[model samples]
Target: MFAEFRKFVMRGNVLDLAVAVIIGAAFATITKSLTDDVIMPVVGWIFGGFDFSSYFIRLGPIPEGYTGSVNNYAALKEAGVPLLGYGAFVTTVINFLILAFIIFLIVRSVNRMLARFEHQKPEVPAAEPTDVVLLREIRDELRKRPAE
Candidate 1:
């Protein structure tokens, strides 16, 4: 059992998968940061600097006494309101697009490199010509026969 376990651990495919998982996790973090911290804010600034996150409609009812705009989704939800978080969904979609684009570029590069390697002609041993072999055989026979 120990030997089998050792073999499984030492397999090339397993090692490759472990490395891929580590790298993928690291890449995910980087892309998440880029999407959330950098891209979304710029997009938010573009449309009259209105923050989409603060945009939500209150469904149930606005209290007659309380008159203030609900700046967050949680506040509206607490007021017995059904909220549609379209902005959050858009942000999530952006994150997915960024991550997917990064992955696509990586996969494309790897595929190009692999395709280049695959298309390279392999060195093959030259085959002996049939006529050459026949000629050699005839020469050998002439030499082997005793002089008349």
Candidate 2:
């Protein structure tokens, strides 16, 4: 049972999955940074500096007429506020779009490269004109020579 478990753990698919998970985590970080740091900022600038990161709604009773900017999401929750956190969602959506676009470009390029590679595979050489007929002709000539 231990050997079987070890074999299963060392299987090709398991290793492939582990590698994929690690790569996916790294890629997620890159996409998150790209969205939050570069792409979202440009998009926000285009939309009159409208920051989606700060767009949240506080749904609770105002505590003793206290008015202060909520810094973190934890603070809002700590203040007993029911919140609508759409900014993070918007950032996630943007990240997804960028990741999808990059993947599409990669797949498209790979397909084009594969098509060119297949086209260069030398055309199967057209079946080589069948040597059976020539063999039969030689056999008939030898038979006639024996008779002569």
Candidate 3:
């Protein structure tokens, strides 16, 4: 059982999957940073500095001892207030779109590069061996001659 488990773990596909998972995790982190730190801030500025994360509608009455800001979604949730978090949802959708667009661009570029490489490949036919050529010539001569 131990040997079977080791074999499963050591397989080429398994190793490739593990590497892919690690790389995907790293890529997700980078994309998240790009969305949150760089793009979101610029977008916020362009849209007059509105924060999407804090945008929520409280559906239920606030708890009696709650002193947190009414506009804060996290605070309201902590206070056990039922709320609709559309702003957070919108932010997540935007992030997904950006990430998907970037990935599409990357795949497109890779495909184009692969196509170019294929186009540039040489199409010269392989040279026939001298022995095969001589044998063919003999065969042709025999065919041309009458039977003895």
Instruction: Please tell me which predicted candidate would have the highest TM-score against the true structure.
Output: 3
Report lDDT (Cα) of residue 19, candidate 2.
99
Of the pair 1 and 2, which is ahead by lDDT? Answer: 1
Steric overlap count per candidate: 0, 0, 0
Query: Tens digit of lDDT per residue, candidate 1, span 13-116?
Result: 99999999999899889987887788878888886555655555555666565545566676666665677777777878888899999899989999999999
Write the residue-wise lDDT of candidate 3 on 33-109 in tens digits.
77777877777777676565567788989989888888888989887899998867767788788878988999999
Alpha carbon deviation, residue 82, candidate 1 (Å): 5.4
Q: Predict model 3's lDDT versus the native.
A: 0.84
lDDT tens digits, residues 27-105, model 2? Answer: 8899889898988887777767556665667776545644555655556666667887777678788899988898799
Query: What's the lDDT of the predicted structure labeled candidate 2?
Result: 0.79
Residue 74 alpha-carbon offset, candidate 3, angstroms: 1.5
